[model samples]
Target: MSYILEILPSLLEGAQLTLKIFLWTVVGSIPLGLIVGLGLTSHFVPLKAILKFYVWLMRGTPLLLQLIFVFYGLPLIGSGALTLQRYDAALFAFILNYTAYFAEIFRGGLQSIDHGQYESAKVLRLSYLQTVRKVITPQVLKIVLPSIGNEVINLVKDSSLVYVIGLGDLLRAGNVATSRDVTLVPLILVGVIYLLMTAVLTFILRKLEQHYSYWK
Candidate 1:
């Protein structure tokens, strides 16, 4: 117990890193995901094909492999233009992986919308962008908020993968503390921290669902 107390500050520091990664990953990925989702639904055959291929490649492969490739391979292939520090590499990897997954979720949400919505928006004389922004997106968000919430919760846990690239996130912090003291208590503490984070995320997402429910 005393050991746990002693390590509390270090664990909190690690939690900060974990939170930072989670926040940035969501910020960077959400817009990219929306764009990719739009591209996947594009009318242009070539554009659709390209976006489909991108989504497939990202989703089909393991994120760990993708992280290694981005961090290690890019430096080998395009060292000058794609130079990345460890933290940057982890951020890039998480963004790419999460963006692809979120894009699919967004695509699924968009597809769930009825075709009649588009026609109705057109009847209202809204441009394509306006139609999407004002009409389709709101409905889609209502339909997919639950799923997006799950993904967001999962992302909080997944941020631990940043440790693979040497980003000192929560799991890595616990590992470091455990190694020094030769005990597993720190790991348990780390798990509790992660659970707490996920709980908070779930609560926020639930609130978001309720907030958006008015649109339905």
Candidate 2:
């Protein structure tokens, strides 16, 4: 027990980094995902095609590969023009990868909206922005929240991937402890921490789903 207590602080520090990465990725990806979703569904053929290709490339690749490419490969390609620090590289990869997934989810949500809702918006003399904000956005949010919740849960786990680039995330911290002590307790603690975090997120997401359930 004393050994576990001794290692707890370092593990918490790593957890903090993991949380930061998750929060920033969520903030950066969600809006961009919405924009990309909009672009995918837009009438402009060229723009749609470009976004389609972007989404396909992002989704088709493994995020771990993307992280490696961003952190290790980009610097090689452009003479280091896009060199990012380890932390920044992880965030960049995570946001880009998740944005593609969220974009697809949002696109599906947006498309599922009844076409007559748009016709009604036009008849109401609502501008495009207003129509989207007032009519379409709510429905899309309700539809996509479940998927977004899934992604958010995945993000919590995926933040551990930052350890590959030496970011000292929770899993890495646990690994370090286990290596140093030659014991598995630290890793077990790490698992407990992850389960606690996911449990909280599940509760919050369920409440959100309930709040939005009133729409149906």
Question: Cα miss at 192, model 2 (Å)?
Answer: 0.4
Q: Report backbone clashes per prediction.
A: 0, 0
Residue runs of model 2 more than 4 Å from their true location after superposition: none
TM-score of each: 0.95, 0.97
Winning candidate number (TM-score) = 2
Candidate number achieving the greatest lDDT relative to the actual structure: 2
Report lDDT per candidate: 0.86, 0.93
The 10 consecutive residues of candidate 2 with the worst lDDT sum are 158-167
lDDT of model 2 at position 108: 99
TM-score of 1: 0.95
Q: Candidate 2 on 1-216: residue-level lDDT in tens?
A: 899889999999999999999999999999999889988889999999999999999989888889999999999999989899999999999999999999999999999999999999999999999998889988999999999999999999989988778799999999999999999999999999999989999999999999999968
